[model samples]
Target: MAKTKKSARATLPPSIGKVLKRLHHPLDVILLCVRWYVAYSLSLRNLEEMMAERGLEVDHSSVHRWVIKLVPLFEKAFRKHKRPVGKSWRMDETYVKVRGQWKYLYRAVDKAGNTVDFLLRAHRDKAAARRYFEKAIDRNGEPETITVDKSGANLAALEALNADRPTPIKVRQSKYLNNVVEQDHRAIKRIIKPMMGFKDFRCARIILAGIEVMHMIRKGQMQDDGIARNPAEKFYSIII
Candidate 1:
């Protein structure tokens, strides 16, 4: 019996099987719930009803738990397969309400509208800007130039980073040139608007990262191994 159990465990997909161990629902159902929640402007109860219509009795809270648990893993997998973005970055911050308080979501996109990286911070200041820049550069490599909308904090952060580098990055303060990233924020805001607001900071951070991963997949940022996949399929492919 132990040998049989060992064989069964070995047969399961390493990441998915381990991450989903002892879960109640089938993997597909859980993944479907998470993808729909992040990819659309649907609330938790809204997802509950949708699942019910299909004869599944998943609770709204359960779906929420699944999102919190699984989105980070999906984001990790997506980053590994992410395509290379351009070096000219347009960086900005947008507001997201958490527990009735507004928080800043720092985001950036390359010259071709490809996602660079994102970070959610309590305040929009030089420290937060520097953290976001460091994270972005660490993951996607340093950009040749970064365009911002005259935000002193963002410019200051770049300056601080440049002081330590032999080749400094060019910083451009131009709202006009940043129109692409500004408009790109609408897509993320649209999906989260229906949620009204997050109840806590951690929830907001993880879910926002998931949302960004979906948005990146929609923008064709994931390398598909030479096979074409729709946005939804691409999302599942991240884990499967």
Candidate 2:
């Protein structure tokens, strides 16, 4: 029983497990590959060569496909199981290049740190900002308050979207409130710097969504073990 417990402790994150079951890959093979790559920041070719030593034959590209396809699926299903976000919202944007020109991605986060919505647009003007808020409100209804940076876009966005509300929208501008969303973007920067930028906005959006899902998990705002609390920390009751 002790040996069995130690053996079970060696499995990768459950994301790798569900992904393997869904893709019909051998569990040991998939988990081993994922763990090897994540633990050491190895490339697929490196992972493939390492696995080959263990008598599991596979290609670098196949490993890449498995990680890209399944990790996000697991993360998405993981995020959907969370509690609803709070009634306050924070908003921000980051820049990316699309096709040869620069574009902007507008993002919104609820008070509980869940990414409520995002929009990648060619411009960052009043119209684009208004549309991003419009899209989020269309899905989530209006929050009690909206916090953003002192952007004309955000100002116009609230003016456009809350025109019919009884009190309209209270648009407050603050550097600190917007910091949460800005910091949320650092993970994307970390991941993308390794990839040397995305090929297109469509692909970038998918990659961003996957990264955000992972972020939500780390921030204690999303999960799948019947709660959004961190999956890594287990409390062992200590009795004197």
Candidate 3:
């Protein structure tokens, strides 16, 4: 069984569990499906086979259903637990395939690796960039200068924001500056593959948000526990 911490809600909205439990498969089965898929980054089919090995027969479609429905719920709960990103944000987007179609997910992370904002969209056009900016930058009060991978849409949005602002949003672009966000993404890619080819923007959003939170936890970036030890002790603890 995967380790689970009770969310603040104590229970997910009844509507979420009610619908999933209505299916013939039990909630434990569904939880097992979600945990394996999210925690281990197993694909839908892989989840099916893993469960079957333990004598629990399930189909990929059921696996997908479990994920698709629960993603938003997880997204909702995950946000409440994320640490503050504060300022100095780096942003980027990657293309992924979903059912043979392409979509974009724009994400930003602060200097300390805290995820700043994430948006899932069908396209990576100027308009999409604007939408992300209006919601992302506007809500948090402006961060100083923004760094992004070279994308004209990003430049356009930053330019527009600057022009509209009396101070002009400080804007800077550099190829190397985006390495942190890219490294963070690689950590996520190492785990999941359905995202190796995303089927839709919605799925991308759900999966990426969960990943950001997980990454922080694994790296010991959340609140510190004050456990101090020599490097050798830490190494053995991790290996064991």
How well does each candidate superpose onto the true structure, as a TM-score? 0.94, 0.67, 0.76
lDDT of 1 by residue, 22-74 (tens): 67776668888999999999999999999999999999999999999899899
The top-ranked prediction according to TM-score is 1
lDDT of 3 by residue, 107-128 (tens): 7777877767767678888888
Alpha-carbon runs more than 4 Å astray in model 1: 1-12
The reply for model 2, stretches above 4 Å from the true place, is 1-60, 98-101, 111-114, 223-240
The C-alpha lDDT values of all candidates are 0.91, 0.63, 0.66
Per-residue lDDT value at 176 in model 2: 86
Judge candidate 1 at residue 7 and give its lDDT: 52
Best by lDDT: 1
As for lDDT, the candidate ahead, 1 or 2, is: 1
**Model 3, residue pairs in steric clash:** 97-198, 98-198, 98-199, 162-169, 193-196
Query: Weakest 10 consecutive residues, lDDT, candidate 3?
Result: 231-240
TM-score (C-alpha, index-matched) for candidate 3: 0.76
lDDT of 1: 0.91
Candidate 2, RMSD to the unseen true structure? 6.9
